[model samples]
Target: MRLMTIFIALLGSVAVPGLAADVGFEEVKITNGAEPPLTAGIWYPTNAQGTSHSLGDFTQTVAPEAPIAGSRLPLVVMSHGGGGWYGSHYDTALALAHAGFVAAAVSHAGDTFDDQSRVLQLWRRPEQLHRLISYMLDEWRWHRRLDAARIGAFGFSNGGFTVLVAAGGVPDLSKIAPFCDVHADHDLCDALQHAGVERHFGSNVPASAWIHDSRIRAVVIAAPSFGFAFGRAGLSSVRTAVQIWSAADDRHQPHPYYDEPVRDDLPRAPGYHVVANAGHFDFLPPCDARLSRMRPEICNSRPGFDRATFHDQFNADVLQSLHDTLP
Candidate 1:
């Protein structure tokens, strides 16, 4: 991993100047289910008249409760990694909003850090994503100003896997046993081990299920989990343009066993990128001082790597990809 870091540093890639806007922010409650209302954070382009403010652990150049800047703007839905909150990619969401996109992200019911009851239920993630999309387009007050035809999804890790499923890739849960057998030390394996495979996938569970949402016109997936589960046949129905990203030094799900196989097997070639000096958690936003002190392992980076610097480039690449693919 360290060697890979040095190799990337030698490549001399640097962040470039790009588009930006004064972002607007809001917190929403989505009542799509009888269980509990879903919590989400929404970001969108606002007239440059609003003041910057902090949202919980992160501060952004966005004003709370600001009015919309433009009508019929593009929309991007975000899904966070396993055990992550909707605010996991708050920076990226803000970037999208500044780039003339309306972005919203929801906290998975039982899959978040505070709850793990339904984390083992593979279908719940995609279902929740689909529900969020439905609510955003049909019930949200700003739905009228959103361009329905130009919609995209963004995700990382397990969230990445969800976007693929929502984009029409069906995973074979039956392959879990064999995957775990080979990747015994992998994080996915350990998660299943603790959850108990039998409890997660019962006898009635089918080998394949359709979880696609036609509303999602494009997707940007990063360091997806359970990539091997989607073989060529499983991804055959996915027709949307996909932007897939992998880290050269990801060890949690790893390159070989998780993300690479998905990119390689997709029916149509995806716009793929491998960040040389990055790790599984690098796709996440750079942590604040308080967050760094609370979680050093997730906040720390390689000797010369700067997550904040890399994200500037990443945001540009993502904005361009969405514009090109969804336009």
Candidate 2:
């Protein structure tokens, strides 16, 4: 009875009204040459009303297998952070879905939770995202219903780095060792301490590998990693409108080294937001009780801070940027 009561309470907590129009959900798979099949979730506008659909311990207010709403819609491609899944930002995806946009998130083949083989390989990220976009535009079932030219990207953490490359930014692996030497205490430095990144990855990547996709017209990214790698020259190449969000107290990647450089160096004026007293994980969707128990470090916030409330505004700002830029 106690367990049942707890389950009921958790259910009620996440049962809030969704934004704008109703959302439809579907699971899609894209086969990209020899790489593992890319599993993605697509959220889009739908005329059918939605009901709560439970997946594992979490639930989303969506109509599963519902028909598409309009003939052609703007597309938003999402890339999750390191060790993160595509649904890490479901609320954001839902917001885009309700706002008459088709939002799809591809699970980066070797960087996701199930696979971490290539998490340290920085170049593979943009390449994988490129293939994902190509498949979505050229081969996905809904290709005919999508407005090819009106496309944008959303990313978080390392995924943030991926979209920037997709938007024409280049990264220099040479900068990492020097950055780690100075900030050895940082999480990024500690993670690479044992990897021998210089000998293996440094010499392999070409100085001018083309990673940009002209199809992506706008981009929104949060707490991007390897910011110093882009420097000014690499970032200046990015011509698309960008919106960047930062957590005031991010411990993992931290500021100045991560989000600051992008703000200072990008030639294009970017829409920036800094959430006071919030941590890095606060940028992720609010936690349910089950998730709170499973990952308290990320689920808990400062005494007065609320992740859900912040996301309401965060989602709105992102939608406005994409709508304004992509249109």
C-alpha lDDT of candidate 1 relative to the true structure: 0.81
lDDT digits (tens) for residues 3-34 of candidate 1 = 22322342344321222347778899988568
RMSD of each: 5.5, 6.2
TM-score of each: 0.90, 0.90
* Lowest lDDT block of 10, candidate 2: 1-10
At residue 247, candidate 1 shows an lDDT of 86
lDDT of 2: 0.81
Model 1 residue runs over 4 Å out of place are 1-20, 194-204, 207-210
Provide the lowest-lDDT 10-residue window in model 1: 10-19
lDDT of 2 by residue, 1-327 (tens): 222233234334332112234789988887767866788888987889889987544688898888778756888999999988778788888877876788999888788877888887777777778877787788877778788888999999998999999999988877777777788888888777766544235545685674788889999999998888888998888999999999999998887789999989999889999999898889888888888999898788888998877887788778778877886
The reply for model 2, stretches above 4 Å from the true place, is 1-20, 194-200, 208-210
Query: Which candidate ranks first by lDDT, i.e. highest?
Result: 2
Please provide the root mean square deviation of candidate 2 (C-alpha atoms, Å). Answer: 6.2
